[model samples]
Target: MTKHFTMGGTATFDFIELLGGYIVAMTGDFDGGAFARVVGEPRVQGNKTYLDMEHTFIRKDGSTIQTRDQSVLTAVEGEARLLGATTYNVVKTTGAFEGLTGQFRSWGSVDPATGQGVLRFWGSIGEASAKAA
Candidate 1:
C-alpha cells in the first residue's frame, strides 16, 4: 500500500556567485529539525525562471533523503516576493532511512534581500520507507 503524507517548512538561500550558483537551505519541525539543502543552476525563459536542483533532506537523527528538484520561480505581482513551485523525486536515502523512498511537491516564496522563504509540500511514500523526498 502507498503511504501518503504532508509536510510544511521554511527555507532560505545564499548566493555564492552567478557562475557558482546558489545554495538553498531549509528546515522545519519535522523529526526535530529536518534540514535540507538544494544546489541548482538557474535559468530564465520569457517572463519566468527555473532552477534545476539537487536537494537533500537531513534529519537530526542522521537519516537523510535526496532528490532532484525542479523549481519555477516568478516575481509575484510586481512585488519583491518570488513564488515557486517545486517538484522533486527521491533518488537516495541513507542511515535510518536506508530502505525509504518517496517524493514531495512543494510551493514556496522568497524575499530577494533576505532570501528567506515559506514552504509547503506534500506527497506519498512507498511504505520505513517514508515520505518527504
Candidate 2:
C-alpha cells in the first residue's frame, strides 16, 4: 500500500493561437516544493472553451511526474475562470521519486483575473494504484 496525501494549490495558464488551432501553456506550484509545465489544446464551444492539458511536475532537484488534465473556461464574476480535472500517471522520476509508478485524479479551477487558481488531487503512490471514477 502507498500513502495518500490530500494535495492541491495554485496554478496559471496562458493561451496563444497556433496555425492548427490554439495551445495553452501552464505553470504552477504545488504544495510540496514542486512546479509544473503544461501544454494542451483549447477548443471553443458555443458558450464554453475547454482545454486538454498534459502536465509535467518537476522538483528543484529535477525529479518529475506527469498528468493529463481536461478543463473548461468561462466567465465567472467578471473574470475568466477555469474548471477541470486530470488523471495523472507517474511517467518518469528521479531522486526520492525514482521508480515511482502509480496514478491519481486532480480537479481544480483558476481565475484569470488574478492569475491564480486552486486545485485538488488524490490517489496512492509507491506500491499501489487507482482509477478515476
Candidate 3:
C-alpha cells in the first residue's frame, strides 16, 4: 500500500483577465513552493459561475505538479468566493512528483476592486499503484 500525504497552503495572486479567462500567478507556501500559473475559464449562470482552472504547483527544487480544478463562484456578502475540487494525475507530474495521483478541494475569495485574492487547497496524495485492480 502506498502512503497517503496531505498537502495545503495559502497564497495570494492577482485576478488578471485575458482572452475570456484569467491568468493568475501565486506565491507563499503553495503546496511546497509557489503556483507559477493558474489559468481559469469561466461559465456564468444567473447567480453562479462555474470555473475550469488549471493549477501549476512549482516546488522549490523546480519540480512541479499540475492539477485540473472545477469550481463554483458565488457571491457571499457581495463578494466573490470559490469552492472547488481538484484532480492530480500522474501524467501531469514532473521530476520528483512523478507516479503520484490524488484529489483535492480548494476555496478562496477575491477583491474585485484590487484584483487580488487569497486561495487555499488541501487534499490527500498517494501513489498510482495504490489503486485497486
Most lDDT-accurate candidate: 1
- Candidate 3, residue 106: lDDT: 59
Off by more than 4 A, model 2: 1-31, 46-48, 59-62, 72-80, 127-133
Better of 2 and 3 by lDDT: 3
For 1-133, candidate 3 gives per-residue lDDT tens digits of: 6654566666666644553334455444443543333355568886667766666777777777777766666655544544333443323777666666777665677665656667776666767674467
Compute the lDDT of residue 96 as modeled in candidate 3: 69
lDDT of 1 by residue, 6-31 (tens): 44565555545443444555555434
Instruction: Show pairs that collide, candidate 3.
Output: none
**Model 2: per-residue Cα lDDT over 1-133, one tens digit each:** 5643323444444333242322223233333333333455568886567766555666555656665556556544554675656676666656656666767676777665544555566665573456678
TM-score of each: 0.69, 0.53, 0.69
The C-alpha RMSD of each candidate to the native structure, in angstroms, is 5.5, 6.6, 4.0
Off by over 4 Å in 1: 1-29, 32-40, 127-133
